[model samples]
Target: MTSQPRPGPAVFISAGEASGDQHGAAVAREIRRELPDVRLFGIGGRELEAAGVSRIAGLDELSVMGGTEVLRRLPGFFRLQRRIEGLFVTEDVRLLLPIDYPGLNLRLARSARRQGRRVLYYIAPQVWAWREGRARKLQRDCDRVLTVLPFEGPLLERYGVRTEFVGHPLLDAPRSRAAAARDRAAPGVRMTDSRRVIGLFPGSRAQEVRFMLPVFAEAARQLARRHQDLDFLVARPPHLPKSLYAGAGFPTAGAREVTERSWAALTKSGTITLELALAGVPMVVGYRTGGLEWAIGRRLVRIPSIVLVNLVAEAPVVPEFLQDRLTAERVAAELEGLLGERAAGRREMLRAFDVVRERLGDPGCAARVASHAIELLARDQESPGRLGTPC
Candidate 1:
């Protein structure tokens, strides 16, 4: 009997941040399901590990955010990149999938390409948001790019990058299994009898927590005062301490810390909006950052929508409260509307969300990405000197 052709090509993935890790993990799992013998390994966090990916390095261990933070961690980042680049040369990794953390991942992709490895950028960078020129470099480096946004494809095309709009992964996952869960009756802290749950997601970064958590807590207090019967749950990432929320003044005693349990999430922007949508948990999204950061982002951001649900749905299905507008009063009002099943706004939003969820395509995004990587590997081997065509 043949030895299964030595399993398939070895594909390496690198993802940073909680959202990237989740998306990367989904892709890795799908690849395994599609090609049972495919060799998959990566540098990721708990999400990829739980998805059965072999860890080359823990992404969380190397995470640094914001311009100033990244500058502070430059030496360590360089060290990690060198180690990753060394792995590409010595391990002979045929293909590389670099998920959203464009700064670090882009550099790694460039290094991998230099070592003659095919690169597929899963969850392409938000180049359209700012630094649109990155598209040129991406086209020069990567073999293929998979974008979840419909608008991103054309932007990448201008730079001659090969890109595909893989339906948003949020549309693909199983909805949160938790039923109507209402066990809380107050805002600062309260207990309820109903199973209807409200998700509060401050964010993954400490800075975000600093800026948003207190507002979120105050909003929850207001929400509890008005509703008095909704359960509040926080989907805490492993990187954040449970005490992180305590100082923010959101009662943590009865509030569930849903690391990997229950469903529905009230999260910051990015992938969580999509996750909450996929989970079928209706949410009111909110975000807050430093004034300087907001001003800088405003000048750079291209899109009008901040919520991923709106971006994926290409319309507003969920209300987004950002910056100064993201207050306890605003959050409470929005949450009240969503939790109020009879509210027409809530009905309309949920109805649109149902349609959006179906559009996410299939649940095997990571697998499809994996298969794509393997195919690229084969083509690369057939023509070692060819550069991939831009999208």
Candidate 2:
């Protein structure tokens, strides 16, 4: 009698937001290249779907910010978590690859580990910023943590977590040489009759947009009154509807194009700050959330700077107006410095960005992360008995 064939290995990835989706997609593509027959599935957005990952749920369903926001969606998240954990058993998933979205992904990692599945975390949770205790949890749950930031690997290693510095995926992004050169040469100097563009990047999530866009719009109006040559370009995430940006009263476009054309920017504090920095655009960072969320975050956050660019630079290279400080007047005033002809703040930030880029290391980051995950999978197959030891 002919025997039934054994099922191939499977990887379950969870990337809960736009940036994570982008990074996860790149890694997924690389994994497919190396292991063509491997089963790939995940919870991500269009990018991951395009990369051949069969999504159990779209990123929008899982993406929420702030404490209160997450609490309201907690029941759905719990149900989704249960469903995903059930898939580990039914599908015989060999690995759980989580990309960011630490709030949910951390719980999933613990669950996957409990089920004797290997966990490889990408773009590891910023435990260094707030809950340093989570580092120990990562040590216990994740088989390996692939970090994008240069400093994270060292930090995680201290907690006994296996770590790899995979270089930031943003370095692989296509950059506009013209834009970089202009920013480096002029440093936001607005010449006679030359149109200068200031990009407004509120954020990717609906909640973030709701909190930031109106304030950003008011800031734009204030700036417009002062500078006739200045034009506004809002960087809209593709997943969000156009109506979300309608109140901003600016032409909306993709983040890449907007960053390339921008002389300066007023942006939300996140990975986009790093993206703008890499593109050589000086920016003023702002973030606002529900009052309760802001209060809790203020108490929990241990770091001096929340902006990634500033954190990477180890200095406050960009002005951050967060929570109550995130007013239209403050944002406009800070951006004004960035737009001036001989703005020291602008030149200093541009110079710091150069150092930040060099520190991030070279590209091919996704390939490194993919290889690490694939290696972990191979090890598990070779020594199936070792899978449940650490957990």
Candidate 3:
């Protein structure tokens, strides 16, 4: 009998949240398009599953925000980590592609490096915001780091990390939707329909939703009382149960659809702020967490602004309320100034958003990421010893 050819190498992807799942799925599709027979597997969510990645674990078990919240789920995370490490062995995973979720992915990268697996980190951790040492850790553990932000490449390179600016993935989203919204309501022209929509984006994690949804709802109620034509829509994450949004007193929809129709938004800080900016929605950003998390975060975060839009714009393009300051009344007050098409704050924010978009680079971010991943895999195969050393 003829000996069978050896099975091709498999890739393990770890995308620990909703946004990462979307990015991971896009990259996975692009990867398969180039290498149809390559096996893709690991931890992700519904999007990854639909993209043909064999998930060993789901985001439901892994997605949590704040240090204190993660502590509560520590035992489960440890178990999942061990399970993933085992999959690396059994599945013969040659490459580890980690997308964000630095908390767990960083640990896994270290483990994979020890096992002679090459690691390519995507959507790099916000080390500039906090724990700046993680930049060195990423350099030590990852073979290459792909960043979405324009400035992150130079920052990571300073730490001697192999870095690439793949451009912001948000730009890949259809601009026509946002463009149409803007066309419908030009800078000086109010909506002829006499109705305006406000999107309330609570965020993807359970902790974020639990902490932010009620406050957002209350803000919406306040805004509703002041303006009769204003309508509120909640951008609900698919993973969260409907009951989580049940008493929020607003109609719930997918984030993209809500963003496309929004005149302005009350949003929780994080990637959603960037998404809202991309959609040209003037937004008031807010974030709240458990007391322990807030106390610890306030001390650790190095940057003055937590909002991504402001960070990208390199200016305070939108109002941000965090921790103790994130009251519904305060959010409503800030949002009130952004309610009109001709509102000064709204017009100025939209202009800043335009600058933000221009700086984000062109689209095809996922394709570039996939190309790099494949190149790394090929190089590893040709000279395994080059990436074999553990950090």
* Model 3 lDDT per residue over 1-391, tens place: 9999877679999999889999999999999999888899979899999999999888788878877777888999999999999999998888999999999999999999888889999999999898899998898899889999888888888889988898999989887555575856656765656788999999988888999999999999988998999999999878888998999978999988899888889998889888888887889999899898888888898897999888889998889898889999999999999876678888899889889999999999999999988988898788887676532
Cα deviation of 167 in candidate 2 (Å)?
0.9
As for model 3, its CA RMSD to the true structure in angstroms is 1.5
Sorted by TM-score, highest first, which candidate order results? Answer: 3, 2, 1
What is candidate 2's CA lDDT for residue 76?
99
lDDT tens readout by residue for model 2, 1-391: 9999876689999999999999999999999999988889889899999999999999679868888888899999999999999888888999999998888899999999888899999999999888889999899999888888888988889989888888999999877974646654653444444888999999999999999999999999999999998999998877888998887779999888899888899999889999989998899999999988878777889889999988888988889998888999999998999887577888888889999999998999999989988898899989988897653
Q: How far is candidate 1 from the true structure (C-alpha RMSD, Å)?
A: 5.0
Span of ten consecutive residues with least summed lDDT in model 1: 182-191
Q: For residue 41, what is the lDDT in candidate 2? A: 87
Q: In angstroms, give how far residue 17 of model 3 lies from its true place.
A: 0.6
Which residue pairs collide in model 3, if any? Answer: none
- Give, for candidate 2, the lowest lDDT window spanning 10 residues: 184-193
lDDT of each: 0.72, 0.89, 0.89
lDDT of 1 by residue, 75-173 (tens): 887888888787766666778899888888889888877777788998889887788989988988898899887778998898888898776765555
Worst 10 residues of 3 by lDDT: 177-186
RMSD of each: 5.0, 2.0, 1.5
